[model samples]
Target: MAAETSDQYETLQIQYPPSHRRGPLPLPPVSRWALGSVLAVGTGGFLVLGAALAALVTLYVQGQAELREARTELLAAGAPLLPPNSPRSPGETPAAAQRRKDQLGRWLQGLALGWRYHQGSIYFFSSERKRWDDAQLACRASHAHLTSITSAEEQEYLARESRGGTYWIGLVATGPGGSWHWVDGSSYSSAQSFWAAGQPDNSDHGEWGRESCAQIHPVGNSLWNDHNCNFTFFWICKRDLSGP
Candidate 1:
């Protein structure tokens, strides 16, 4: 009985290998809850990173659009990057705000040339020729009048620009036979006289009986001669507005 029992015990021990003998596993105890917590945290971090990237992309697109719009507006106004007297408001992006300010600055710079301000009368010299009456009528139509030489400087300017052409002036004779007067009714009291030798003779048959017009010649000096009103010459027209 003892031998049989020993053999049975040995067989039972052989069947259950020592390595397979069950007890506590050969690893340290692990908390399932802690492991799950770690996994959750890693997943949460990945999601957060993805969301942040998405937000950044959206913001970048919006910024680019706003910049494009600002550029277009500036170009349309023929304005520089900035303008004057521009105000900044809340919620404006940095680029958009800067663009508006630049446009304002440009406007200020052009104020002197009537770009953003009202300029006074402007004057121009016409190279076209017309009769005395026709010239006067043209000036009236253009909201201007024939220039009246009020000073020596003015006469000199006209003389230089006219280049010796017999230009019409605001002077005419009003007498029945030989009386002459300026359009402003001023008598011929200029200290500076620019007459050719043996002028005002009224000798020729060409309006000699009724010579009543002023002619300026480009004789390198601001000299003028009185002639008949019917003579045609290129005239200058002065406007009432200022130009650059």
Candidate 2:
């Protein structure tokens, strides 16, 4: 009877693998408060990042607006516009500013009339011809003097502007032995002078030292030539904007 009972009990018991549990497995206990905390932290981080970006954009826009206002103020102050790499204009007293404006207007008008401005001097080319003395008089009447060429650049410009015509300048042989000088009382320097080949041949060319005036000759490669002062020719005048 005992043997039969043990066999019956063993038949009634059943075995299953650990992974084959019938009902859903129990989950670990989770806190609702912790989940809410995590969500709040994440939301706050996103808000901070968005606020930072907005602040940066606002700063950039304000900076640009300030830069524009500064430029406008500078322009209103009568400051000249310069290149980015150029030096700023120096400050000037009210008197100095007025003086500069007075001179600048005249130079600008001369520029409008096709005159060339350089180093505070405005050069004008005459359409008519006149003797050297008469040309000097005309220039004085116009508040100017006969053009005095100081550098090779000036000579080249005058040559180009002359359009292959003769033009009288301010240089003359004023000294006893044909020493050249400029009309502004500046000594004529050979180093700065541009003379044509075999020029100023005064008496040697039968002028009897009468070729006291200098003229820009279109011939002989467009260089200076000593001509008789009485000869009528187109001339150039220079008005200095630099005050005494």
**lDDT, residue 191, model 2:** 86
Clashes of 2: 0
| Best model number under lDDT | 2
**Stretches of candidate 2 exceeding 4 Å from the true structure:** 1-94, 118-120, 203-209, 240-244
Clashes by residue pair, model 2:
none
lDDT of 2: 0.69
* lDDT (10s digit) by residue, model 2, range 103-186: 445544555565655544667888987888899999887667888888888788888878888788998887778888888655
lDDT of 2 at 115: 61
